[model samples]
Target: MTRPEAPHALAITFFYYRDLPRAMQFYEDIIGLPLAIDQGWCKIYQICPGAHVGLVDETRGMNKWSAQKPVQLCIRVVDVNAWYAYAREHALDGLSELFENDQLGIRAFVFHDPEGYQIEIQSATRAGA
Candidate 1:
């Protein structure tokens, strides 16, 4: 028989660089996620209030992408302007300025990690747009 599920969600996952150190820096410094685990060959970074993305050493056959790399992580935030400001303050490479979309209804910017994974930071709404 199957075991009962935990009361809480275990985690939300995202693919990251095969390199552990670079992955840690990208998520922890650039992305601003806290480092939950900093093992020598593996690291896990928390992306949201309760979500984590792990970087492993490819022992589990993970690391490389099969086809096209995954794009877009639509993380929700309390404020759009503040989020935009924070990304600007960091000034990491490939940091796109806030842009609005009528259909999606968000103001968002994009950043790239060491492994060239695209991470989009978005706000639910932008001022005057």
Candidate 2:
């Protein structure tokens, strides 16, 4: 028998930050995600069609950013090189050179957010190239 589908229409990943304003600016100005919701204590940004990232104030969040970050947000896009160029032009810290992974069949790069969360932007490698 087939299992029933979940009722959720979108998936949201939360990143707790000590400085909410800084986090919001990064997601808005740097990453260029559109603000979808603002719940006073938290702000949600739409990363893509049905995916979102929520930035929450540490005082109001379930957890806080620590020395050891336990989460990495991965955004799948059509052009990894374009993203890399944009990040570099913005002087984003921890930006990595684009590389390919044969096993994963993807080309991607990574950069750190204001609160030290790793954000990976990737694109599927072409079949014949």
Candidate 3:
């Protein structure tokens, strides 16, 4: 099947955090995503070749988190087990054991960032699965 070209060079998902530095540190030091752009109020991290995540300070961002969070950032990786081990060592919040989902065709684990943002790390069950 032929695929159409994407219109944008990169895609970024932004999350608003009450404490920007804490979020930045979690993504940079723990998750190990490289800093792609550092705007004064918002920091962007490169997730992969064409995908990025932006961390925005609640005071500077348009929205704020209250009783509920509306986003879950899922990252597809080559080694879900490695990430799960790292999370275990770091004592990350809301860590979950690696499990398979035949419906989703992935083996994944879930954890929370510093600000309670759900992050899922997963690998395909099989090649292109």
Best candidate (score: TM-score): 3
Our model 1 lands, by Cα RMSD against the true structure, at 4.0
lDDT of 1 by residue, 1-129 (tens): 998876776475656455667777666776677887666556767776577777766545345543355675656677767877877887766788788887777777787666666677776664543
The candidate 1 region of ten consecutive residues with least summed lDDT is: 59-68
User: What TM value does model 1 have?
Assistant: 0.70
Deviating ranges (above 4 Å) for candidate 3:
1-6
Q: Positional deviation of 13 in candidate 1, in angstroms?
A: 1.3
TM-score head-to-head 1 vs 3, winner: 3
List, residue by residue over 12-63, the lDDT tens digit for candidate 3: 9989888899899999999999999999889999999999999999888887
Winner by lDDT between candidate 2 and candidate 1: 2
Ranking by TM-score: 3, 2, 1
Candidate 2 lDDT score at position 64: 68
Clashing pairs in 3: none
Reference-based TM-score of each model: 0.70, 0.90, 0.91
